[model samples]
Target: MELQFFLPMIPPTCTHQEKQVSVVTGKPVFYDPPQIKAARSKLTAMLAKHRPERPIKGKGVRLIVKWLFPKGRHQDGEYRITKPDTDNLQKLLKDCMTEVGFWKDDAQVCSEISEKFWAAIPGIWIRVEEI
Candidate 1:
């Protein structure tokens, strides 16, 4: 199975690694910051519309994601080489995808390719397939 689509919106830069930790009862407790929660909500809502009729199951699945940010000082199609590393970005995105029933679990994603770019048209391009 293969799924490909583009979500037209400003890609959020918040990452899963942004989780905040606090010492509660002398133990570490982790929580998402407001921005992280907001980012997850936004991505979940956007991804919900694209969920497959049935969630993809089993192993050997591949996920490809392209995050296109607005071209401010950068030229169109230029690679974004700044903060919000791709692994961090994909971690949040895969979590959202798992929540929205895109697959049984993000662990099913055996292969992943993620990129960020400056583009005149800002959005997210995603492709999920069996490999």
Candidate 2:
């Protein structure tokens, strides 16, 4: 099946219920599954290749630390990727989706990407403002 993709700039935000207050008070939230999956898959592949031998127990992919760590406390603060990282992932997703003839409107692509990302990265949060 074909999957569509989009590259929308999302603001840095928290996913915890306490932080969700901003998302709740601000704009409507939307998520995309396909694009997210593609992007996440691409990221996973990259991480695996570059960070092979990293421990993966309960805390997702561990690179620097020794032994497995339970996903650390959110109080440690939310994780945010750089713009280049986001752009690289988006390009990879778009290329994959385009091959499957899934490229569509911007909103649809963003939703797919968000959904996939959320599923792949547990505890990670993403908040986007509606256009």
Candidate 3:
């Protein structure tokens, strides 16, 4: 089965790698900052409406996500090769997808294709399929 959808909103700038760390009780603790928390919340809310009836399982799932940001000085549909690495962006999105029941675990997604672009219409394009 394949699930695909487009979410019309500016993709979050904050990535999962933005997690903050602190020393508490002489131990290291990791936490998300306010901005990161907000990003996650927004992503979760948007993804909730697209959740699959049953979480995808196994290790043969494929996920394709395209992040479209506002076209500032760049041309529409042009690839954004700058900051907020693709892996970091995918991390946060996959986490939210998991939280919203897109899959039993992100590990089930063995094949992934992620890209970022500067677009006239900002949004996220998501495609999930079982291989």
User: Mind sharing the TM-score for model 1?
Assistant: 0.96
Candidate lDDT scores, in order, read 0.92, 0.30, 0.93
Model 2, residue 71: C-alpha shift (Å):
5.3
Full ranking by lDDT: 3, 1, 2
Q: Cα lDDT of model 1 overall?
A: 0.92
**Model 2 Cα shift for residue 62 (angstroms):** 33
Question: Runs in model 3 with CA error above 4 Å?
Answer: none
Candidate 2: C-alpha RMSD after superposition? 16.7
TM-score of 2: 0.25
1-131 per-residue lDDT for model 3 (tens digits)? 78999999999999988889999999999999999999999999999999989887764789999999999999999999998899999999999999999889888889999999999999999999988
Candidate 1 per-residue C-alpha lDDT over 77-97 given as tens digits, one digit per residue, 9 for 90 to 100: 999999889999999999999
What is residue 129's positional error in candidate 2, in angstroms?
14
The sequence of per-residue lDDT tens digits that candidate 2 reaches over residues 1-131 is 21112222232221111111124558765543554554445544433332213222222111111111122343222333322244443444334333432223323333323322211223322222222
**Descending-TM-score candidate ranking:** 3, 1, 2
Top candidate, metric TM-score: 3
